[model samples]
Target: MLITPDISTLSYKRQLAKRFDRASRSYDSYADFQKIVLDRLLAMLPLSQADVVLDLGTGTGQALGILSQQLKPKCNIALDLSPQMLTVARERFSALPNLHCVCADAERLPFQEKSCDLVFSSLAVQWCLSPLDLFNELFRVTKPGGYVVFSTLSQGSMPEISQAWVGLDSQRHVHDYMAQDALLDCIKASGLNLLSSQLSDILMWFDSPEAAIYSLKKVGASLIAGDAHSSVSPTRWKAFLREYEKQRDERGVPLSYQVSFIVAQRPAIV
Candidate 1:
Protein backbone atom coordinates (compact mmCIF):
# COMPACT_ATOMS: atom_id res chain seq x y z
CA MET A 1 0.00 0.00 0.00
CA LEU A 2 1.16 3.54 -0.70
CA ILE A 3 1.70 5.38 2.58
CA THR A 4 0.73 8.86 1.44
CA PRO A 5 0.76 11.91 3.67
CA ASP A 6 -2.40 13.48 5.15
CA ILE A 7 -2.84 16.05 2.42
CA SER A 8 -6.61 15.52 2.22
CA THR A 9 -7.59 18.43 4.46
CA LEU A 10 -9.12 21.57 2.96
CA SER A 11 -6.56 23.81 4.63
CA TYR A 12 -3.69 21.83 3.22
CA LYS A 13 -5.24 21.95 -0.24
CA ARG A 14 -5.54 25.71 0.03
CA GLN A 15 -1.94 26.04 1.06
CA LEU A 16 -0.89 23.96 -1.92
CA ALA A 17 -2.88 26.11 -4.28
CA LYS A 18 -1.46 29.31 -2.82
CA ARG A 19 2.07 28.09 -3.21
CA PHE A 20 1.57 27.19 -6.86
CA ASP A 21 -0.31 30.43 -7.45
CA ARG A 22 2.54 32.49 -6.04
CA ALA A 23 5.06 30.62 -8.13
CA SER A 24 3.23 31.14 -11.42
CA ARG A 25 5.41 34.09 -12.39
CA SER A 26 8.69 32.35 -11.62
CA TYR A 27 7.70 28.81 -12.64
CA ASP A 28 8.54 29.04 -16.30
CA SER A 29 11.97 30.53 -15.65
CA TYR A 30 12.91 27.95 -12.99
CA ALA A 31 11.22 24.94 -14.61
CA ASP A 32 14.03 23.75 -16.85
CA PHE A 33 13.65 20.19 -15.62
CA GLN A 34 9.90 20.31 -16.12
CA LYS A 35 10.35 21.40 -19.71
CA ILE A 36 12.65 18.45 -20.42
CA VAL A 37 10.28 15.98 -18.81
CA LEU A 38 7.33 17.44 -20.71
CA ASP A 39 9.09 16.82 -24.00
CA ARG A 40 9.80 13.21 -23.06
CA LEU A 41 6.16 12.63 -22.05
CA LEU A 42 4.92 14.20 -25.27
CA ALA A 43 7.11 11.86 -27.28
CA MET A 44 5.19 8.91 -25.82
CA LEU A 45 1.96 9.98 -27.46
CA PRO A 46 0.92 8.34 -30.73
CA LEU A 47 0.59 10.46 -33.85
CA SER A 48 -3.15 10.90 -34.02
CA GLN A 49 -5.83 13.59 -33.92
CA ALA A 50 -8.51 14.00 -31.29
CA ASP A 51 -11.57 16.16 -30.71
CA VAL A 52 -10.72 17.11 -27.13
CA VAL A 53 -7.52 16.97 -25.06
CA LEU A 54 -7.27 17.69 -21.35
CA ASP A 55 -4.03 18.96 -19.81
CA LEU A 56 -4.39 18.05 -16.16
CA GLY A 57 -2.32 20.18 -13.77
CA THR A 58 -1.33 22.35 -16.65
CA GLY A 59 0.95 24.62 -14.62
CA THR A 60 1.55 27.80 -16.59
CA GLY A 61 0.33 25.86 -19.64
CA GLN A 62 3.82 24.97 -20.83
CA ALA A 63 2.67 22.08 -23.00
CA LEU A 64 -0.40 23.74 -24.51
CA GLY A 65 1.41 24.99 -27.60
CA ILE A 66 2.92 21.60 -28.41
CA LEU A 67 -0.29 19.68 -27.68
CA SER A 68 -2.34 22.01 -29.88
CA GLN A 69 0.16 21.93 -32.71
CA GLN A 70 0.71 18.16 -32.59
CA LEU A 71 -2.73 16.71 -31.82
CA LYS A 72 -4.75 19.37 -33.69
CA PRO A 73 -7.60 18.87 -31.23
CA LYS A 74 -10.79 20.83 -31.71
CA CYS A 75 -10.68 21.89 -28.07
CA ASN A 76 -7.88 21.95 -25.47
CA ILE A 77 -8.76 22.16 -21.79
CA ALA A 78 -6.04 23.26 -19.39
CA LEU A 79 -6.95 22.42 -15.79
CA ASP A 80 -5.08 23.20 -12.59
CA LEU A 81 -5.70 23.77 -8.89
CA SER A 82 -4.18 27.27 -8.89
CA PRO A 83 -6.31 30.05 -10.31
CA GLN A 84 -3.25 32.25 -10.76
CA MET A 85 -1.57 29.52 -12.74
CA LEU A 86 -4.61 29.28 -15.00
CA THR A 87 -4.58 33.05 -15.38
CA VAL A 88 -1.01 32.86 -16.57
CA ALA A 89 -1.94 30.07 -18.96
CA ARG A 90 -4.92 31.95 -20.36
CA GLU A 91 -2.85 35.06 -20.97
CA ARG A 92 0.00 33.10 -22.52
CA PHE A 93 -2.22 31.14 -24.91
CA SER A 94 -4.73 33.84 -25.76
CA ALA A 95 -4.16 33.42 -29.45
CA LEU A 96 -5.41 29.82 -29.40
CA PRO A 97 -9.18 30.19 -29.67
CA ASN A 98 -9.77 26.51 -28.96
CA LEU A 99 -7.90 26.59 -25.64
CA HIS A 100 -9.88 26.69 -22.40
CA CYS A 101 -8.47 27.05 -18.88
CA VAL A 102 -10.16 25.64 -15.75
CA CYS A 103 -9.03 25.76 -12.16
CA ALA A 104 -9.89 22.40 -10.53
CA ASP A 105 -8.54 19.45 -8.62
CA ALA A 106 -7.07 16.48 -10.41
CA GLU A 107 -8.69 13.90 -8.11
CA ARG A 108 -12.16 15.35 -8.76
CA LEU A 109 -12.02 16.59 -12.33
CA PRO A 110 -14.83 18.92 -13.43
CA PHE A 111 -15.37 17.29 -16.80
CA GLN A 112 -18.15 14.87 -17.76
CA GLU A 113 -17.71 11.15 -18.18
CA LYS A 114 -16.13 10.09 -21.46
CA SER A 115 -15.69 13.70 -22.45
CA CYS A 116 -12.01 13.96 -23.34
CA ASP A 117 -10.43 12.01 -26.14
CA LEU A 118 -6.95 12.33 -24.61
CA VAL A 119 -5.66 13.36 -21.18
CA PHE A 120 -2.03 14.40 -20.73
CA SER A 121 -0.16 15.45 -17.62
CA SER A 122 3.49 15.81 -16.77
CA LEU A 123 5.11 15.96 -13.33
CA ALA A 124 1.82 16.82 -11.66
CA VAL A 125 -0.25 13.97 -10.18
CA GLN A 126 2.17 13.04 -7.38
CA TRP A 127 0.90 16.02 -5.39
CA CYS A 128 -2.56 14.42 -5.10
CA LEU A 129 -3.71 12.74 -1.89
CA SER A 130 -4.01 9.36 -3.53
CA PRO A 131 -2.81 8.01 -6.87
CA LEU A 132 -5.76 5.59 -7.04
CA ASP A 133 -8.25 8.43 -6.70
CA LEU A 134 -6.38 10.43 -9.34
CA PHE A 135 -6.25 7.57 -11.85
CA ASN A 136 -9.91 6.80 -11.26
CA GLU A 137 -10.76 10.40 -12.10
CA LEU A 138 -8.69 10.17 -15.25
CA PHE A 139 -10.39 6.92 -16.25
CA ARG A 140 -13.78 8.49 -15.64
CA VAL A 141 -13.16 11.64 -17.69
CA THR A 142 -11.42 9.89 -20.57
CA LYS A 143 -13.57 8.64 -23.45
CA PRO A 144 -13.63 5.02 -24.52
CA GLY A 145 -10.46 4.09 -26.41
CA GLY A 146 -8.90 7.40 -25.35
CA TYR A 147 -5.48 7.63 -23.75
CA VAL A 148 -4.04 8.93 -20.46
CA VAL A 149 -0.37 9.83 -20.26
CA PHE A 150 1.40 11.22 -17.20
CA SER A 151 4.72 11.45 -15.38
CA THR A 152 5.16 11.69 -11.59
CA LEU A 153 7.93 11.66 -9.06
CA SER A 154 8.69 8.26 -7.54
CA GLN A 155 10.49 7.18 -4.35
CA GLY A 156 14.12 8.14 -3.69
CA SER A 157 13.75 11.55 -5.29
CA MET A 158 15.90 14.41 -3.97
CA PRO A 159 18.20 12.39 -1.77
CA GLU A 160 20.64 15.26 -1.44
CA ILE A 161 18.12 17.37 0.46
CA SER A 162 17.31 14.54 2.85
CA GLN A 163 20.94 13.74 3.38
CA ALA A 164 21.72 17.33 4.27
CA TRP A 165 18.85 17.52 6.76
CA VAL A 166 19.79 14.30 8.52
CA GLY A 167 21.33 15.80 11.68
CA LEU A 168 19.70 19.23 11.60
CA ASP A 169 16.21 17.85 12.33
CA SER A 170 14.00 14.87 11.60
CA GLN A 171 10.71 16.65 10.94
CA ARG A 172 10.19 15.23 7.47
CA HIS A 173 11.54 17.99 5.27
CA VAL A 174 11.22 15.99 2.07
CA HIS A 175 8.02 14.82 0.47
CA ASP A 176 7.26 11.15 0.95
CA TYR A 177 7.23 10.15 -2.68
CA MET A 178 5.47 6.87 -3.52
CA ALA A 179 7.42 3.77 -4.32
CA GLN A 180 7.40 2.40 -7.88
CA ASP A 181 5.56 -0.77 -6.90
CA ALA A 182 2.86 1.16 -5.05
CA LEU A 183 2.35 3.51 -8.01
CA LEU A 184 2.10 0.58 -10.43
CA ASP A 185 -0.41 -1.06 -8.11
CA CYS A 186 -2.54 2.08 -8.13
CA ILE A 187 -2.53 2.14 -11.92
CA LYS A 188 -3.52 -1.52 -12.13
CA ALA A 189 -6.26 -1.01 -9.56
CA SER A 190 -7.68 2.04 -11.33
CA GLY A 191 -9.05 -0.20 -14.18
CA LEU A 192 -7.20 1.65 -16.97
CA ASN A 193 -5.51 -0.76 -19.32
CA LEU A 194 -1.78 -0.57 -18.67
CA LEU A 195 0.01 0.22 -21.90
CA SER A 196 3.66 0.98 -21.06
CA SER A 197 5.62 2.58 -18.25
CA GLN A 198 9.25 3.60 -17.66
CA LEU A 199 11.21 4.57 -14.56
CA SER A 200 14.41 6.63 -14.68
CA ASP A 201 16.45 9.13 -12.73
CA ILE A 202 16.58 12.75 -13.92
CA LEU A 203 19.63 14.49 -12.53
CA MET A 204 19.99 18.26 -12.49
CA TRP A 205 23.19 20.15 -11.72
CA PHE A 206 23.39 23.59 -10.22
CA ASP A 207 26.14 26.13 -9.64
CA SER A 208 25.56 26.04 -5.88
CA PRO A 209 23.45 24.29 -3.25
CA GLU A 210 21.26 27.36 -2.75
CA ALA A 211 20.48 27.52 -6.44
CA ALA A 212 19.55 23.84 -6.44
CA ILE A 213 17.16 24.30 -3.51
CA TYR A 214 15.78 27.55 -4.90
CA SER A 215 14.82 25.81 -8.12
CA LEU A 216 12.33 23.68 -6.22
CA LYS A 217 10.89 26.65 -4.34
CA LYS A 218 10.47 28.73 -7.48
CA VAL A 219 8.40 25.93 -8.99
CA GLY A 220 6.15 25.68 -5.88
CA ALA A 221 7.48 22.16 -5.26
CA SER A 222 9.22 23.00 -2.00
CA LEU A 223 6.23 22.34 0.26
CA ILE A 224 6.08 19.08 2.15
CA ALA A 225 2.73 17.32 2.46
CA GLY A 226 2.00 17.70 6.19
CA ASP A 227 4.47 20.48 6.94
CA ALA A 228 3.55 23.10 4.39
CA HIS A 229 3.40 26.02 6.81
CA SER A 230 6.62 25.42 8.71
CA SER A 231 9.72 27.50 8.19
CA VAL A 232 13.31 26.58 8.83
CA SER A 233 15.39 28.84 11.01
CA PRO A 234 18.36 30.64 9.47
CA THR A 235 20.89 28.74 11.58
CA ARG A 236 19.56 25.37 10.55
CA TRP A 237 19.19 26.56 7.01
CA LYS A 238 22.82 27.64 6.88
CA ALA A 239 23.92 24.33 8.37
CA PHE A 240 21.96 22.52 5.67
CA LEU A 241 23.76 24.48 2.97
CA ARG A 242 27.12 23.43 4.42
CA GLU A 243 26.14 19.76 4.53
CA TYR A 244 24.81 19.89 0.98
CA GLU A 245 28.06 21.50 -0.15
CA LYS A 246 29.88 18.38 1.02
CA GLN A 247 27.92 16.42 -1.57
CA ARG A 248 29.35 18.48 -4.40
CA ASP A 249 31.54 16.79 -7.01
CA GLU A 250 32.85 17.52 -10.49
CA ARG A 251 29.31 18.32 -11.68
CA GLY A 252 28.62 21.01 -9.04
CA VAL A 253 25.68 20.53 -6.61
CA PRO A 254 23.29 17.81 -7.70
CA LEU A 255 19.57 17.31 -7.28
CA SER A 256 18.07 14.11 -8.56
CA TYR A 257 14.55 12.78 -9.22
CA GLN A 258 13.19 9.32 -9.85
CA VAL A 259 10.41 9.84 -12.39
CA SER A 260 7.84 7.38 -13.69
CA PHE A 261 6.21 7.80 -17.09
CA ILE A 262 2.93 5.98 -17.64
CA VAL A 263 0.62 5.45 -20.60
CA ALA A 264 -2.79 3.80 -20.34
CA GLN A 265 -6.06 3.57 -22.21
CA ARG A 266 -9.73 3.29 -21.27
CA PRO A 267 -11.16 0.16 -22.80
CA ALA A 268 -13.85 0.54 -25.43
CA ILE A 269 -17.29 -0.87 -24.67
CA VAL A 270 -18.14 -4.03 -26.59
Candidate 2:
Protein backbone atom coordinates (compact mmCIF):
# COMPACT_ATOMS: atom_id res chain seq x y z
CA MET A 1 0.00 0.00 0.00
CA LEU A 2 1.17 3.52 -0.75
CA ILE A 3 1.39 5.98 2.10
CA THR A 4 0.91 9.69 1.55
CA PRO A 5 2.43 12.17 3.97
CA ASP A 6 1.32 15.61 5.02
CA ILE A 7 4.27 17.22 3.28
CA SER A 8 2.32 20.45 2.95
CA THR A 9 3.18 21.33 6.54
CA LEU A 10 5.91 23.93 6.75
CA SER A 11 7.01 22.49 10.06
CA TYR A 12 7.63 19.11 8.44
CA LYS A 13 9.66 20.69 5.65
CA ARG A 14 11.72 22.68 8.16
CA GLN A 15 12.34 19.59 10.21
CA LEU A 16 13.58 17.71 7.17
CA ALA A 17 16.01 20.49 6.24
CA LYS A 18 17.29 20.93 9.80
CA ARG A 19 17.95 17.23 10.25
CA PHE A 20 19.93 17.10 6.99
CA ASP A 21 21.86 20.24 7.94
CA ARG A 22 22.83 18.73 11.26
CA ALA A 23 23.86 15.55 9.50
CA SER A 24 26.03 17.25 6.87
CA ARG A 25 29.36 16.51 8.55
CA SER A 26 28.67 12.81 9.02
CA TYR A 27 26.52 12.12 5.96
CA ASP A 28 29.28 10.94 3.66
CA SER A 29 30.55 8.40 6.15
CA TYR A 30 27.29 6.42 6.23
CA ALA A 31 26.09 6.95 2.68
CA ASP A 32 27.24 3.64 1.23
CA PHE A 33 23.81 2.72 -0.11
CA GLN A 34 23.46 6.14 -1.71
CA LYS A 35 26.75 5.70 -3.51
CA ILE A 36 25.72 2.29 -4.82
CA VAL A 37 22.42 3.56 -6.15
CA LEU A 38 24.08 6.61 -7.70
CA ASP A 39 26.56 4.46 -9.59
CA ARG A 40 23.73 2.35 -10.98
CA LEU A 41 21.76 5.44 -11.94
CA LEU A 42 24.75 6.89 -13.74
CA ALA A 43 25.26 3.65 -15.63
CA MET A 44 21.71 3.84 -16.98
CA LEU A 45 22.23 7.24 -18.58
CA PRO A 46 23.10 7.31 -22.28
CA LEU A 47 26.60 8.60 -22.99
CA SER A 48 26.23 12.12 -24.31
CA GLN A 49 27.34 15.67 -23.67
CA ALA A 50 25.10 18.34 -22.18
CA ASP A 51 25.84 22.05 -22.36
CA VAL A 52 24.44 22.75 -18.86
CA VAL A 53 23.54 20.24 -16.13
CA LEU A 54 21.79 20.60 -12.82
CA ASP A 55 22.49 18.23 -9.96
CA LEU A 56 19.50 18.63 -7.70
CA GLY A 57 20.01 17.67 -4.07
CA THR A 58 23.69 17.24 -4.69
CA GLY A 59 24.60 16.05 -1.20
CA THR A 60 28.24 16.69 -0.34
CA GLY A 61 28.81 16.95 -4.10
CA GLN A 62 29.22 13.21 -4.26
CA ALA A 63 28.06 13.06 -7.90
CA LEU A 64 29.92 16.22 -8.94
CA GLY A 65 33.30 14.70 -9.75
CA ILE A 66 31.88 11.73 -11.62
CA LEU A 67 29.36 13.89 -13.47
CA SER A 68 32.10 16.32 -14.43
CA GLN A 69 34.22 13.45 -15.69
CA GLN A 70 31.39 11.84 -17.64
CA LEU A 71 29.06 14.48 -19.07
CA LYS A 72 31.69 17.22 -19.09
CA PRO A 73 28.99 19.84 -19.30
CA LYS A 74 30.11 23.44 -19.80
CA CYS A 75 28.37 24.38 -16.51
CA ASN A 76 27.30 22.26 -13.52
CA ILE A 77 24.87 23.52 -10.91
CA ALA A 78 24.73 21.76 -7.56
CA LEU A 79 21.55 22.54 -5.65
CA ASP A 80 20.24 21.36 -2.27
CA LEU A 81 17.65 22.31 0.32
CA SER A 82 20.16 22.26 3.14
CA PRO A 83 22.55 25.19 3.27
CA GLN A 84 25.15 23.22 5.18
CA MET A 85 25.10 20.51 2.51
CA LEU A 86 25.58 23.13 -0.21
CA THR A 87 28.41 24.63 1.80
CA VAL A 88 30.18 21.29 1.89
CA ALA A 89 29.56 20.72 -1.83
CA ARG A 90 30.85 24.16 -2.69
CA GLU A 91 34.08 23.62 -0.75
CA ARG A 92 34.50 20.15 -2.22
CA PHE A 93 34.12 21.35 -5.81
CA SER A 94 35.43 24.88 -5.37
CA ALA A 95 38.33 24.41 -7.78
CA LEU A 96 36.14 23.23 -10.64
CA PRO A 97 35.42 26.02 -13.11
CA ASN A 98 31.79 26.90 -13.92
CA LEU A 99 30.52 24.86 -10.95
CA HIS A 100 27.79 26.73 -9.05
CA CYS A 101 26.38 25.65 -5.69
CA VAL A 102 22.91 26.89 -4.83
CA CYS A 103 20.93 26.39 -1.63
CA ALA A 104 17.41 25.97 -2.96
CA ASP A 105 14.40 23.71 -2.66
CA ALA A 106 13.94 21.22 -5.48
CA GLU A 107 10.22 21.91 -5.67
CA ARG A 108 10.85 25.58 -6.39
CA LEU A 109 13.85 25.87 -8.65
CA PRO A 110 15.40 29.31 -9.06
CA PHE A 111 16.29 28.88 -12.70
CA GLN A 112 14.87 30.05 -16.00
CA GLU A 113 12.60 27.72 -17.95
CA LYS A 114 14.22 25.45 -20.54
CA SER A 115 17.70 26.50 -19.47
CA CYS A 116 19.32 23.24 -18.46
CA ASP A 117 20.09 20.32 -20.71
CA LEU A 118 20.22 17.66 -18.00
CA VAL A 119 18.75 17.31 -14.49
CA PHE A 120 20.02 14.66 -12.11
CA SER A 121 18.92 13.93 -8.58
CA SER A 122 19.74 11.03 -6.28
CA LEU A 123 17.90 9.88 -3.17
CA ALA A 124 16.54 13.37 -2.56
CA VAL A 125 13.10 13.82 -4.06
CA GLN A 126 11.44 11.55 -1.48
CA TRP A 127 11.95 14.28 1.09
CA CYS A 128 9.84 16.69 -0.91
CA LEU A 129 6.26 17.11 0.32
CA SER A 130 5.04 16.63 -3.22
CA PRO A 131 6.82 14.47 -5.76
CA LEU A 132 4.61 15.93 -8.51
CA ASP A 133 5.80 19.41 -7.65
CA LEU A 134 9.39 18.28 -7.87
CA PHE A 135 8.85 16.57 -11.24
CA ASN A 136 7.07 19.65 -12.54
CA GLU A 137 9.96 21.83 -11.47
CA LEU A 138 12.44 19.53 -13.17
CA PHE A 139 10.38 19.49 -16.34
CA ARG A 140 10.08 23.25 -16.32
CA VAL A 141 13.81 23.94 -16.04
CA THR A 142 14.82 21.30 -18.56
CA LYS A 143 15.37 22.38 -22.16
CA PRO A 144 13.21 20.78 -24.81
CA GLY A 145 14.61 17.31 -25.48
CA GLY A 146 16.63 17.52 -22.25
CA TYR A 147 16.81 14.63 -19.81
CA VAL A 148 16.07 14.13 -16.11
CA VAL A 149 17.61 11.12 -14.46
CA PHE A 150 17.05 10.27 -10.80
CA SER A 151 16.87 7.55 -8.16
CA THR A 152 14.60 7.47 -5.14
CA LEU A 153 13.39 5.10 -2.46
CA SER A 154 10.21 3.24 -3.28
CA GLN A 155 7.69 1.31 -1.21
CA GLY A 156 8.99 -1.60 0.90
CA SER A 157 12.31 0.07 1.70
CA MET A 158 13.69 -0.69 5.15
CA PRO A 159 11.12 -3.33 5.87
CA GLU A 160 13.20 -4.64 8.73
CA ILE A 161 12.96 -1.31 10.54
CA SER A 162 9.25 -0.95 9.84
CA GLN A 163 8.58 -4.52 10.88
CA ALA A 164 10.41 -3.94 14.16
CA TRP A 165 8.04 -1.13 14.97
CA VAL A 166 4.98 -3.15 14.04
CA GLY A 167 4.06 -4.42 17.50
CA LEU A 168 5.26 -1.24 19.17
CA ASP A 169 3.32 1.96 19.72
CA SER A 170 1.53 3.87 16.97
CA GLN A 171 4.28 6.45 16.59
CA ARG A 172 6.05 6.37 13.24
CA HIS A 173 9.69 5.32 13.39
CA VAL A 174 10.46 5.09 9.67
CA HIS A 175 9.46 7.39 6.86
CA ASP A 176 7.02 6.05 4.30
CA TYR A 177 8.43 5.52 0.83
CA MET A 178 6.48 6.24 -2.34
CA ALA A 179 4.84 3.34 -4.13
CA GLN A 180 6.32 2.49 -7.54
CA ASP A 181 3.11 3.02 -9.44
CA ALA A 182 2.57 6.38 -7.78
CA LEU A 183 6.03 7.52 -8.74
CA LEU A 184 5.53 6.49 -12.37
CA ASP A 185 2.20 8.28 -12.42
CA CYS A 186 3.80 11.46 -11.13
CA ILE A 187 6.42 11.33 -13.88
CA LYS A 188 3.76 10.91 -16.55
CA ALA A 189 1.65 13.69 -15.08
CA SER A 190 4.58 16.12 -15.22
CA GLY A 191 4.51 16.05 -19.06
CA LEU A 192 7.84 14.25 -19.32
CA ASN A 193 8.11 11.09 -21.41
CA LEU A 194 9.35 8.19 -19.38
CA LEU A 195 12.22 6.43 -21.05
CA SER A 196 12.88 3.68 -18.56
CA SER A 197 12.50 2.78 -14.89
CA GLN A 198 13.77 -0.09 -12.82
CA LEU A 199 13.24 -1.17 -9.21
CA SER A 200 15.75 -3.14 -7.19
CA ASP A 201 16.52 -4.08 -3.63
CA ILE A 202 19.73 -2.96 -1.94
CA LEU A 203 20.72 -4.45 1.36
CA MET A 204 23.19 -3.29 3.99
CA TRP A 205 24.33 -5.34 6.93
CA PHE A 206 25.34 -4.24 10.42
CA ASP A 207 26.79 -5.97 13.42
CA SER A 208 23.61 -5.37 15.32
CA PRO A 209 20.44 -3.32 15.30
CA GLU A 210 22.24 -0.62 17.27
CA ALA A 211 24.87 -0.40 14.58
CA ALA A 212 22.22 -0.08 11.92
CA ILE A 213 20.48 2.66 13.88
CA TYR A 214 23.78 4.42 14.40
CA SER A 215 24.60 4.33 10.70
CA LEU A 216 21.22 5.79 9.85
CA LYS A 217 21.59 8.49 12.49
CA LYS A 218 25.03 9.37 11.22
CA VAL A 219 23.54 9.98 7.79
CA GLY A 220 20.81 12.18 9.30
CA ALA A 221 18.26 9.80 7.77
CA SER A 222 17.05 8.46 11.11
CA LEU A 223 14.83 11.43 11.88
CA ILE A 224 13.48 11.58 8.33
CA ALA A 225 9.90 11.01 9.42
CA GLY A 226 10.10 14.30 11.34
CA ASP A 227 9.00 12.58 14.50
CA ALA A 228 11.36 14.50 16.78
CA HIS A 229 9.45 13.66 19.95
CA SER A 230 8.83 10.00 19.21
CA SER A 231 10.54 7.66 21.59
CA VAL A 232 10.51 3.99 22.52
CA SER A 233 10.45 2.84 26.08
CA PRO A 234 13.19 0.50 27.28
CA THR A 235 10.90 -2.50 27.11
CA ARG A 236 9.63 -1.60 23.66
CA TRP A 237 13.12 -0.86 22.45
CA LYS A 238 14.28 -4.26 23.59
CA ALA A 239 11.40 -5.94 21.81
CA PHE A 240 12.11 -4.01 18.68
CA LEU A 241 15.74 -5.07 18.72
CA ARG A 242 14.77 -8.66 19.23
CA GLU A 243 12.41 -8.48 16.29
CA TYR A 244 15.04 -6.90 14.07
CA GLU A 245 17.53 -9.61 14.96
CA LYS A 246 15.28 -12.25 13.42
CA GLN A 247 16.28 -10.94 10.00
CA ARG A 248 19.99 -11.44 10.65
CA ASP A 249 22.09 -13.47 8.24
CA GLU A 250 25.71 -14.63 8.10
CA ARG A 251 26.70 -11.16 6.96
CA GLY A 252 24.89 -9.37 9.81
CA VAL A 253 21.57 -7.63 10.54
CA PRO A 254 20.06 -6.69 7.20
CA LEU A 255 18.59 -3.35 6.19
CA SER A 256 16.72 -3.58 2.91
CA TYR A 257 16.12 -0.64 0.57
CA GLN A 258 13.87 -0.69 -2.46
CA VAL A 259 15.27 1.83 -4.93
CA SER A 260 13.71 3.14 -8.14
CA PHE A 261 15.81 4.46 -11.00
CA ILE A 262 14.05 6.54 -13.64
CA VAL A 263 14.96 8.31 -16.85
CA ALA A 264 12.65 10.76 -18.61
CA GLN A 265 12.90 13.23 -21.42
CA ARG A 266 11.22 16.54 -22.29
CA PRO A 267 10.02 16.24 -25.87
CA ALA A 268 11.58 18.60 -28.35
CA ILE A 269 9.20 21.01 -30.04
CA VAL A 270 8.83 20.64 -33.79
In candidate 2, clashing pairs total 0
Compared with the true structure, the alpha-carbon lDDT of candidate 1 equals: 0.89
Candidate 2 C-alpha lDDT tens digits along 156-203: 888788787786777777788899999999999999999999999998
- The predictions' CA RMSDs to the true structure, in order, are 3.4, 4.0
What lDDT does each candidate get?
A: 0.89, 0.86
Looking at model 1, residue 92 earns an lDDT score of: 96
List ranges where model 2 is wrong by over 4 Å: 1-8, 227-230
In model 1, which residue pairs have backbone atoms overlapping below 3 Å?
A: none
Off by over 4 Å in 1: 1-8, 226-230
What is the C-alpha lDDT profile of model 1 across 41-130, one tens digit per residue?
A: 999995479899999999999999999998999999999999999999999999986898998889878789999999999998888886
